[model samples]
Target chain A: MATAVVARPVSRTQTRSREEEVLVWPDLVFIEFIAAMLFTITLFLLSFLVNAPLLDQANADVTPNPSKAPWYLLNLQELLLHMNAAMAGVIIPTIWLVIMGAFPYFDREQHGQGVWFGTEKAVRLTIVSAVVGFVGTWFLILWDSGKIAFFLHGWFGLSGGDSLRFLENVRSVQTQLPWPEWSRNITYSPVNIVIIGEDFQHLDFPAWLVEQGIPTMAMVGMSAMLIFSLWRVGWVVTRRDALIVLFSAFVAAYGVLTLTGTAFRGQGQELVFPWELKVSEGIPGQE
Target chain B: MTQMQPSAGAAARRIEHARQAEARKLSRRSFLRVSVFAGLTLSVGAMAAGFLGFFNLRKPTGFGGVITVVPARVPKAGEEPSRISEGKFWLSNLAGAQGDVAGVGGTGGILALYWKCPHLGCTVPWNPAFNGAAVNFPGIVGWFRCPCHGSTYSRAGIRVYGPAPRPMDTMAVSVNSDKSLNVNTGVITSGGPDNPLRAKPYSG
Candidate 1:
């Protein structure tokens, strides 16, 4: 008996030679070098066209009316206008960074790798998130600035004095929550409540708490509501899609806040038209 | 059958060796590529970080350090505050009674007042219009006026009018052996009802 060897058949597609092959040296490196050169040229042109203005030397005694943080940190500074400084400056940023870092773990899919707006669903989610963030932040800023609040107050015929009296009375109460006399009495201490507490203290802690709490609650509640809507609408089928929506929202909100802080805030951190801003007496570098 | 089993076992061992050799070669190539990329990234990152760090380096002479404002001879008793641009402050020569209230030393005390307004930190300038000759201030001469807000300070750096919560802040002043005024910008004393005058008498 004679032994015979068998061979597997090759398909025409497999046999065809590749027309293009990507190599890192010239393909990727050249593009990178060109991009870097263009960026440098742009920066050089900007330096010549725009002169960086130096304000009068730092004077500790005379702080500018609307003291502002650096440009990158303006988002937090803008948040400071609506909420507690610790929450805006520390808590929010820390949470954002941690979430961003953990995004990769949540989005473990190999599908749609290295593609912008990877899927049609992703693009829609991003657009929806961005719109939600932009409109929400814009409304919050206007509301916190007393622009909308005062308008509605007048429109509703609510007397400013009555509103202030109500707030004062609520603040004077010993407990964190105004209702139930027993809760107030239980928490009350003669030395701490009357002296060290917000009752007689120079700084109005109760007023600050109420002022800061409303905006904080609104921000958190709205974000939670958005996520819940996405889940209920079935737009967020996967963790990757959910992350895409959240990341886009965060980016949009950050951009809006930075723009607002840089151009909108004027004397006393009050909202003003960019053209009407009196930079001479306001924040440094604005002038 | 026993002889055929040994031959089959040897063939299997030989095939495993070839596969292990191929894997080693592939891994070696990948390791080199990864290391090279990492090195490039790290060097670029380090250079960029170094460039950015340069901007944060501060000089030893400015805001937080001591600066010599002016010589003692420039400011005369009951005269206007001599503005020193370099030190960003005003040097005033007050009478002994005013100095006593200001907490300064010397026959006629010397006080260094920060040019910044106590209200909102705007630069305050001595307005000659509000001097004794002017009727607006009523017997006040060489009063400091803030351009931002209408906070007015008397010659002694005391807040006399407007929304200023307290008097103008003072810096520690020392007289050198050469009689030049050395203003310690580092030590800032807040002006309030309890300590309205925070003047450090020039010690020669």
Candidate 2:
């Protein structure tokens, strides 16, 4: 602290001119200081009331069942279910980050600098998009659970008709079931979205297309479809308005995936009620 | 040095010339600084190169190379898989006659599955009780289940369930005269369309 000195004669502190310029120290930094103090006090009080969501001391041998990423990364962990590890854990996230990083360059709107929503329509669209995102993602999770179909038949004694066959029959699900739970039916019928009535019933699609490509495509396709549908309904007029829906949906989806990964996931990463979560993969010989 | 007072412009020109001369000549302090920087860079570069040169170093042959697993440690047909922690593999003796799995031969001999799951490298543990309703395959209990993403595989190391792209990778095996199993950890093969043959015919 004692090292603070006027090293230069023309330092920021020795400003001679007083143009209508906002100074950083008292104006911005003071606000930040007050905000930081408020945050620290709030956290202190919260810590007294609530326990930190950290695990017990880690062990080398016993791996926790459904070993989860931190809440922030759990969304990407959720992505692991439907794609190759390289694709899910790396490529897609990298692409997303690049897209998000480039967003400022693409989105150069002059207005609505300080406002939450650009327009009243944007506000309504944001809420609607959020709801759509939450429900749609929830529906997708349920669809992929391999449980919805199992439950409909197992619990309700329903045949394929009475079951949630619709989820299973989603052309992508029917075609590109990537996971082991998706059954070992993929190998027998390699890949290539499959156009019949020709000698070559299949086209070589670089294995990943079957594993990650379809699901990733579906995710992008669904978002595109949502945007297109919303646009057709006249709710979205400008590019920013459309972007509002997309961003809102993305944020809501991020929240939903995090919640799902944290709470609903169980042993073997299966979807289970929070109550049913048995922590470890279960020590090998103990069982 | 001139005794008479020089003009201002002439003095300034001389000073400029002197400054240029001063800039060109390397001082002892600057020389020391440069030598120190060079030494630091060379040593650091050498250390970094040494670190990377580890890959160029010949891989030692024994545990990581051709591992001659103990003969008695191998599992019998239709029994629990034997885990060779040192070799990073599991030896499963599948009984093909039970019709539990497809692609296995009639005898369903020993299959050495690399313990690392294809999903994300979490070591898959064999769950004997992971059977009946738990797995898609009915009546078949023994399975290699990856805890990471729940990528499960058959006793024959076939990708049965989970997010694994392919079946558990298998290492090349050759039997010795004394019946000691020699698993070449180096000679790896994917248990997919590339190499249809998964297991070597071993009673163990």
Candidate 3:
């Protein structure tokens, strides 16, 4: 976790003497009294300036466009866009929680306990992972939304974005798949599977491939890729370093997802600029 | 003589006697602390139970009750779907839908699909015209397309694409002797797996 970088309290207790010892009655109590008075005054002024507004009455019909989860859950909501709802909404979060719970057991090195960063390389790793995680997640979201395709097509007149129609404009716009000819032929060819756009929806194999196979493989593959790259770079030699990278990445991803879900997502959960966001009140004409 | 086991009354009296003996040791501060904690626990426990019972999925009544539709309103196997906004369902027949979608329900029957998108409960509308260019689905004219998460479903309510967990939910439809359907919105079953089960045929 990134520790709050507020002012560190002076460790006067380390060199304590009876001469410096203060009584709890007037000395400590007076300071506390002043603090309490200051807080009370600040709160009074704040409340006077800011008014709490009541929201619209909850309605069952006509879903509010861009219906968002609470801020804490926006990450999961954003994840729900990229893959299967079960994997995105349920299984992934559950698995993540379990792994985090078991993280202490995996990293038993006694050096890091009770400290914000225990290892010598921790500060460097945190910054690197944070940047990589935040940027990588933002990039992936854009790529999935086909904004990258839109840009490539706009800039270079590149014409491979049509291959992304696998989901029929379901989760993304037309993706410019500038992949080689062999991959294209293999991809769009009538497969006995669900991931191949329209032809395979009737079959069971394709459904599993789309809903289960791809998500699981993508998660595993990405993590493996990260670890492998880190190992090769000599950045992650120990399990502790690897875990720190993973944790830092996770935190960074969580933050980026929250930001994306909050700001970047426009109507219909489409990726758009923050200014483009319009809350469709589901009022017939206005919508 | 062996000691006789205490009777219910005797046991209660003995517990009362023990309580009184223990009560003698309780100072006012400890007594107040114990009583306050006990009161808080009781209120919190009652509230938790109240919340569970309040939100429990009982029969969806009022707007979500059984909706009966005459035979004429039910769409043909490949026609435009009839929407019941009040009932939150689309009445469509999937028997003769083009493409591989005809595989559902064999000869097909009248399917009462709950309009709520299985992904996040946005009402899905049926596309009136087939647009081959609008994605990969060959014939999407009579398909249910969700605008919320872009989850599209075949006429049979199977998840064609998007992040929908499964097929759109189906309300139980009972065909009557006169060819009318009594669709119970209260009883909802998942589309189940990738391929949705066939609905009961209204007529040949």
List, residue by residue over A137-246, the lDDT tens digit for candidate 2: 88777656555556665688665542333343222233233335334333443443433312233323444454666678767887888889888989887777777888
lDDT of 1 by residue, B1-204 (tens): 988999999999999999898877758778899999999999999999999999995655766678875465457666766776556677777655452322333345677778787655667766644432122222444566654444556666765433454578888888777778678787777764223244445433
Top TM-score model: 2
Q: Candidate 3, what DockQ?
A: 0.23
Candidates sorted on lDDT, descending: 2, 3, 1
- Local accuracy of candidate 3 as per-residue lDDT tens digits, A137-160: 887777666566556655786645
TM-score of each: 0.42, 0.65, 0.54
Candidate 3 residue A192 Cα shift, in angstroms, is 25
Q: Interface RMSD of the predictions, in order shown?
A: 11.6, 4.1, 4.1
Model 1 DockQ reads 0.04
How well does candidate 1 score on lDDT at residue A80?
59
Deviation of model 2 at A46, angstroms: 38
- Candidate number that wins on TM-score, 1 or 2: 2
Candidate 2's C-alpha runs over 4 A off are A1-62, A101-113, A157-206, A281-284, B1-62, B97-107, B131-136, B176-180, B193-196
Local distance difference test, per candidate? 0.63, 0.69, 0.69
**Candidate 2 residue-wise lDDT at B147:** 63
Distance (Å) between predicted and true CA of A164, model 1?
9.0
